[model samples]
Target: MEKLVIGLVQTHDDAEAAAERVIDCGYTRQEVSLLMTEATRDRCFPSPDVAPPSSTFGAAVAMSVVVPDLGFVVAGPLAAVVASAVGAGITGGLREILITAGVPRHWAERYQAGVRQGGILVSVFARSERDVGLLHLVLDDPHMTSFHTEAHRHHAYDTSF
Candidate 1:
C-alpha cells in the first residue's frame, strides 16, 4: 500500500483555465470534472448538482482545490458525507472524513464556517499522475494521460458500519 501520484488535468478548458494551468505548474491539489459543462459547472462551483450527462448542459462544480503552501483556494471533499462534516483538522492525519481519505466533513465545515466561497474537487478516486505536481502542466496528451494503481477499490477507513 504505497503509491501517490495524481495529476489528471483532463480539460476542454475553463475551470479558471483549468485553474490557471493548475497554478502555473507548481501544483497544489486538483481533481475536477465537469465532463459535461453546465455553464462551466455553474461558474465554478455555485452548485445544485449543475447536471450534465446527456448533452444539453450540466455537470459543473468540478472540484478539488487546496493550493496549500502556494496559498489560497483551500477546500476539498469529493464526497463522503462532505468529508465527514469537515471535522478533523483537514489534511493533517488525513482527516478528510467521509470515513477518511480526503475532503468532506460537510465540505470542511463549509470551508471552516465561512460558507464556501471557493471550490474544486470532484474525483471519486483514480488520480495518479505521480501524486499530482502539475504533471507537466496538464497531461498534454501523453496518450491522453497515463498512470494507474488499482484504479478503483473504494471502502477506505470504514467509519463503522
Candidate 2:
C-alpha cells in the first residue's frame, strides 16, 4: 500500500527549506510534491521545474493548467496526475489535485485555501508504514502544520492509499 502526507508552511523560505530537508532525508523529488500559487511560484521555484522521470510514477514534463481564479504550479508525482487530468480536459483546481493525492476532501479544501493565501503545501508519498513514520519524523517540526488544526498542530498531514 501507499500513503500520502502533507505539511503547510507560511513562507517561501520555510517551504524551500523543508523541501531541501526532504531531499536531504533521501526521498527523491519524484516522491515529493509542492503546491503554491502563481505569485509564490515566481518568488520560490524558478528552475526549469521539470520532475525527473520515474519508472514508478510514469513521467511528467512541464505542463501548465490555469484554473479560473488561482493559477498554481504543481511538481513531482502529482504533476503526472494533474497533467493527465488536463489531457482528459478536467479543469478541477487545487482542491481536486490534493484529493487525488490522497488527502481527505475536507483537508484538501482547507489546504487549497491555505495555498491560495500564499502558504505552501508540501506533499509526500510512501509505500510502507515505516516510511510514513519516517516522513512524520522528518517533517513534524514546529514550523509546519497540517490541516487538522489541534490534532495535527505539530504534525504533517497523513493518509494512506
Candidate 3:
C-alpha cells in the first residue's frame, strides 16, 4: 500500500510559488503534484479579491508528498513546511480527511481502534488521485447523484454480510 502525506498551502494567488515550495520541502519530482482540478480552481481557489476571507483569499494550492514507507512519522514536518511557506495554517489532520472522504463513521472508529491495537491504518481515497491527495478531500464530486448511487450500492453489499 502507498502512503501519502497531504498538505494545503494557501498561495498568494501564485501557483508557481506554491509548486516551488513543495519541491523545496524535500519532495521528489514524482512524489509531489500540483492541484489543478476544476473544482479546486473554481471553489477553493477562485479569482483574487473576489472571494471572502472565509473562502480562499487567493489561489489555494495543495500538494501531496508520497512517503515511501513511513507516512505517519513524516506527515507533521511536511505539513508544517508547506503551511509555513504560504503562511497558511494546517487544516484538520489525517483522520479528519479520511472521514471527509466519505469513509463511514464506524469505519473511522474501527480504524482508530485498530491503531490503538498497533495496526497501521492505511487508507485509500477512491476518487481521482490528484483530487483526493492534493485537495484534502474538500472537493465534492460534480457528479454527486451518480457517485452517491454507486456508493450506496457498494455500502449495501458491505452491510449485507
Candidate 4:
C-alpha cells in the first residue's frame, strides 16, 4: 500500500462553506478536502461581531458526519472539536453524532467516554505527502506528532470503506 503523508487541522465551517473555500482556493474536489459541521453552516462561522457566543461545537461534528458522504476519500482533521467555551453541554453529544456519522459504534462509545474523562477528541488523517506537508506549514508547530501513536488510544480508524 502507498502511504500518503497526512496532516490534520481543526477547522470551523459547514460543508457548503468549507467546500466553497476549498473550491474557491483553486483546489478541486480531488486536490483538497474538508469536513464541516451543521451548526457551522447554520451559524455562518459565528461572525466575529457576536458576543456571548451562540454555539459550542461547530464544523468538527459536521466533518465527522460528512466524511463518509464525500464522493472521494477524505483525510481527517487534526483536532476534534472541544467545546472551547464554558457551559458547553455533555461532550457525549458530539461523540454520539460523530459515531453515528462515521466512527465505529464501539470506538465511538469509548472515544466519547474518554472525552467525559478529560480526553482530547480531535484527530487528523492525511492522504498525501503534499497534504501532510501543508498541514505542518499551516500549524507551524514542530512538536506535533507526524503520525498516530499509541497515545491516541481512543481514536477511531477510518470507516468509510
Best by lDDT: 2
Over 4 Å off in model 3, which ranges?
Answer: 1-95, 127-161
Q: Worst 10-residue stretch by lDDT in candidate 1? A: 148-157
Q: Top TM-score: which candidate number?
A: 2
The lDDT of each candidate is 0.32, 0.61, 0.33, 0.34
Candidate 1 vs 3: which has more TM-score: 1
lDDT of 3 by residue, 41-95 (tens): 4444446567555432232323233322222321222233333423433244334
| TM of each candidate vs. truth | 0.27, 0.69, 0.25, 0.28
Deviation from native of the Cα of residue 35 in model 3, angstroms? 22
- How well is each residue in 1-161 modelled by candidate 2, as lDDT tens digits? 56776777776556656666777777875677776776866665443434322212213113433344438777676666666656666567877766665667887788788887777777677656666666665554465444336544333334432
In candidate 2, how many Å is residue 134 off?
A: 2.2
lDDT of 1 by residue, 1-161 (tens): 21221222233333335444544554443333222223323454444354444321122233433333222232333433333434334443222332244434543343232212223222323234343433333422232222212221221222222
Error of 3 at 106 (Å): 0.7
lDDT of 3 at 127: 31
Cα deviation of 76 in candidate 1 (Å)? 13
Write the number of the candidate with greater lDDT, choosing between 1 and 3: 3
lDDT of 4 by residue, 1-161 (tens): 11222222223322333334344434443433332343323333443344224323332333433222221112233222222211234234545444534555655555444433323322333344454444323322222233223333333344232
Better of 1 and 2 by lDDT: 2
